[model samples]
Target: PLGQLPVLEIDGGKFPQSLAIARYLARQLKLGGKNDLESLKCDVIVDTMQEL
Candidate 1:
């Protein structure tokens, strides 16, 4: 399915991929970790969660 549902449209451009799109929006809205260590932990959780 090339035309996916979870697409991120920014500045007149479009980006796809589920996890990537989620991460981009999370970073944009400052909804993720607060520091390097926390960010790493968050990334691990996200990666593992995506696998499931």
Candidate 2:
């Protein structure tokens, strides 16, 4: 089941999936790490959560 919406604001955009929104924020904040490896790790974790 889908989770509740997060009570956060963005630059004139709203994202339904909290995890996706988090990833976007991470990228924007430069906390997403340096290279493909970091991105892949993030993707894997998100995928794993979805699979659960």
Candidate 3:
């Protein structure tokens, strides 16, 4: 409902922004990266792909 793109819903609350939502879920699930540097690299790749 918040625009045409998909959003994250939690406890009946709707959250916009795909990237932020994804990052939050990744962190919660411990799937972001094993280290900070790895996390940074993952973020870069995800962001780059999002831009394309």
Candidate 4:
């Protein structure tokens, strides 16, 4: 969707972008981190990787 690569088609919905998909899975699987800071770090790394 929205011309983004690696779209995730799940539960009859189309979610776009790798980061979006990863975050969804992380929340569902309890792997986003133990607290807000940890989660922010994970997000920063993922976003930086995407930028790279």
Q: In order, what is each prediction's RMSD in angstroms?
A: 1.9, 3.7, 1.4, 1.4
Highest-scoring model, TM-score: 3
Order by TM-score, highest first: 3, 4, 1, 2
Enumerate residue pairs that collide in model 2.
none
Lowest lDDT 10-mer window, candidate 3? 1-10
TM-score of each: 0.74, 0.59, 0.81, 0.78
lDDT of each: 0.80, 0.74, 0.84, 0.88
Q: Which residue pairs in model 1 clash with each other?
A: none
lDDT of 2 by residue, 1-52 (tens): 2445763456675557767776887898887768999988887887787788
* Tens digit of per-residue lDDT, candidate 4, span 1-52: 7888788898798888898888888888998889999999989988998899
Query: Model 2: which ten-residue window has the lowest total lDDT?
Result: 1-10
- Model 3 per-residue lDDT tens digits across residues 1-52: 6584668888998888878877898899998999999899879977987899
Candidate 4, residue 39: how far the Cα is off, in Å: 0.6
| Candidate that scores best on lDDT | 4
Q: How far does residue 35 in candidate 3 sit from its true spot (Å)?
A: 1.3
Q: Looking at model 3, how many pairs of residues clash?
A: 0
How many steric overlaps are in each model, in order? 0, 0, 0, 0
